[model samples]
Target: MTDIPNIPFVDLASQQNRIRADIDKAMARVLDHGRYVMGPEVAELEAELSKFCGAKHSIGCSSGTDALAMVLMAKNLRAGQVIFCPSFTFVATAEVVAWLGAKVCFVDVEPDTFNMDPKALKAAIETAKANGEDLAGIIVVDLFGLPADYVSILKIAEENDLWLMSDAAQSFGARYHNAPIGTNGIATATSFFPAKPLGAYGDGGAMFTDDDELAEDLRSILFHGKGTSQYDNVRIGMTGRLDTMQAAVLLEKLKIFDSEIVERQKVADRYTSGLSDIVTCPHVPEGCQSVWAQYTTRLPQGLDRDALQAQLKDKGIPTAVYYAKPLHRQDAYKHNLIAGQTSDGVLPVTDALSLDVLSLPMHPYLSDDTQDYIIEHIRGAISDLS
Candidate 1:
């Protein structure tokens, strides 16, 4: 197909151009060091991340999935223990639990925010208690770069004696009540996956914690459970080390992370301003700051998502569905389903969200010219639907 004013879903190149020299220098320095695995770059990146998160420890790991698995193993939430998470989240949130033999109890999400609903979470806990099940922990995700209601979630965790872990994968650069997500949870995990707000060039992730002993326990798990020595294994663990090359790329990216976040917000503002009349714009709760990792919008009633996406594609405006299926309906996880008392046809919020929501091109360098054309085409499409 000829380029009909084509725009990429993520314009990494435009952002790269601004920091090309610095990025090259950082990589060249790593090449000269000759320490590819667990090199100085790894430690340097960890230190920088810890500083950014305002935490005492930031243990780097191979990927976001590994970062989550490391925390699940560190805490040792035993098998048969029920963990509450939103069914509307990415699979990794529930995958780690199933991998460790723990049961994931799917909770409904808030309609506006598309995050774990505190009310539904409380009801799930109550239902589990009523049925005589052991509840272990709650993993609240900062979905789409916006932190969930941490204050309420934390209060509930304390009351139930359940460990709280913040899955800040999308929300790593976001803020809640002027404080970062890592500081709120007992320990938080974030992904530097290439699409995240503060993403690296490749797979990398980190765990943030305040407790001294807890931090050490997690570090041990990431390095094969060695007790201060590579050969000394005291407990079961996994090989989850973040690559030195990935860390090198992230260290350079971190220098401008704050600026990138600012620009992302600007781009989000422009997107919503242009498209709100044609669709239901994303809701970033008051007192929360989203990194705008995805500028998603809901199609107004009576508009078909497929038709709109097809129209945009034809017009060179790319859009994507973050998820077309909620976790409960996924074939791989059907056997492990632990949804609370409800009809199979229900889970209204998660179900409707699966159909109506679609994400537009979003990144720091989405030029106004491109965005304008994209929004204009969308308005034309919605009008056509009307």
Candidate 2:
């Protein structure tokens, strides 16, 4: 092994340096105004994001988890109502459902795209009905920045009369059949967790929708259920407002998001071309664009994933597994599932994905030189292991 440059999985500093002047000024303005909570920048960012994503309204919230929860809250979900979701994702996606006292009917995902499988979703819905459970809605995750099969999933939602929510926390800037992610569902939730394609300096999130009534309810729920005035409470809510400082940071980042998404595509293309022979690279369906959120790939069967990570680590290359454990397997959710909600037998696809997935260094700021270094070492490591 020779010298290898250390690569940060997400190069936030490089991104920050590109717009340091704009960021500094924006933060300074917020500090001078002294209105930290729900200040001008908050509304400004909401308007900017709403216009950019073609959503009639965008509401900024505390975090991606809060954003999803707020939408569910506005929908007035209750216990025993089943919300179907994929198990092959971050816990936040399904946890929000359980928190609202709704049963999370776990579904499998497509092996290629790693997004929710509409067939599995339909099966879950029917199973829920067969077991005499109430079908409330479906939350489709845009896993690893690729939008789920909205063409099929939307049809299912419509046929079943279920409220469809797109959890675009990773695929915020992605596209589905020429339309932005935010427009794909009745409501879309995204995160600004400093690692997302279009991230803020700290925690933040937003929900996008064209529904006038839903948007109003979300705003009210976001502000502790304030109606007419801040002091007047009309409904139960949480302190879910996106702070002014994070909003200011996101405003500047939003300007360059489109171009950065292009850069991300280039990086992913290069990685796929270089490593496809050795590993199972991510797949993007036709007419879809992924922001390449994590650049996750699967290990070949019989190759120990953790061993490969150790090999890469010795050479200063970093790797991660997005979700090593599926949500259904987690102790917190193991016993709480409703009957007939397991997608036929066990969620085999989700279970398999949890064991095989490995996220490589991915970010728009990842330079071609760094990519070459990472790819060379990965190829070498796989070859040696083979």
Candidate 3:
């Protein structure tokens, strides 16, 4: 405890400095244009993002949470309809379903990819059906920048007649089998929550789709259901337009996203090589690539996770828990959640996972010196406990 070094979980300044000039220019233009709500920048960003993600249309919304909510609303998903999701993700993914009064069925995740476990997903759908949960959709979350098993996940949705929505909040730039994410689902939602791989300066998100009808529905629903004018409310809607300033910021950030993705891969690789034996590292399956939003590693057996974090903190390295608890155990939705269980009532897999995950400081800008410092401390911590 002599001198605590300052190491952030994510260093946005490193990226900010690289595009400071463009950012300033974009801000100046937005200010001079004066269309803060649904400005020209909004359309431009939508176009750019759609093209980037290989989608036919992309609609900007208030935040990633709103983006998900808008899609749910536009689809007319009712309260009693059941939706399947992984309990391993940020709450925003499942919260949207509950906000619409839908039943949430918590699915388990793969210990390696940290994405939805397709086997568990199939079983969950069956479980919901057997229990009369009235399944309507399945949201596939791209956890920690790695795309879920979309190939199989989408197949499950097709067989079950459930809408497939890609919750790509953390995996906007990730790919599966050489195909981009947004185009895979009926609607794909991504967040520009400042810390995301392709974040805006503040809260913002976008929905992408090729279904022209759904796209139009989303557009109307996003702006108070205005057919051609704001006062014309055609359908039930919400005030969820993306801010002009945030669009401007994202446009500039998008310029370097491709390169940033390449750098992210290198950083992830370094972490795996440097610390693979010390703990369980994230695994990117064959034909899949992640943007490396968080280089999470599982704690060694019997090692105290809290003590490990304290040790890393003492040495100028930082860490985080992606989620310390599963959604089924959470107070908000515990009443409605259907945990993955066997016919005789067994869920040892999920029971073991809730206590093991830890996210290390990960971003494209992690320097070699910083990486070495972090690795040294992490190794020391793991070694000390033994």
The candidate, 2 or 3, that scores higher on TM-score is 2
- Candidate 2 vs candidate 3: the lDDT winner is 2
lDDT of 3 by residue, 1-386 (tens): 65656777888999999999999999999999899998999999999998898999999998999999999998899978888888778989889998988888878788778778889889888878888777889888998899998889989899999998989999999988998778877999999999999998889999999999999999999989888887988898988889999999999999999999998888888888899989998988899988888888888878898998888877878888878876666788765565443222233455566577889888888887788778878898889986
Pairs of residues at least 3 apart in sequence or in different chains that clash in candidate 2: none
How many residue-pair clashes does candidate 2 contain? 0
lDDT of 1 by residue, 1-386 (tens): 66597788988787789889988988898899878889999999989988887888989998888888888898887888888888888999999998988887888888888888888888888888888888889989888888899888889889888888989889888889988767777789999998888888989899999989889998889888989686998778889999898899999889989999998998999988998877899898889999887887888866788998999999988899977888887877765556543356447788888888999998988878988898889999999987
Q: How many residue pairs of model 1 clash at the backbone?
A: 0
> lDDT tens digits, residues 1-386, model 2?
45666789889999989999999999999999999998999999999998888999999999999999998999999987888888889999989988988888888999999999988888878878888888888899999999999989999999999999989999999988998889877899999999999899899999999999999999999988999976999999999999999999999999999999999999999999999999999999999999888899988988888889999998888999989978887779855587633443568888788888899998887878888889999999998888
Per TM-score, the best of the predicted structures is 2
Q: Each model's TM-score, in the order given?
A: 0.97, 0.97, 0.96
Clashes of each: 0, 0, 1
- What is the Cα-based lDDT of residue 285 in candidate 2? 97
Q: What is the lDDT of residue 308 in candidate 1?
A: 88
Worst 10 residues of 3 by lDDT: 339-348
List where candidate 3 sits over 4 angstroms from the true fold: 1-4, 338-347
Displacement of residue 225 (Cα, Å) in model 1 is 0.5
lDDT of 1: 0.86
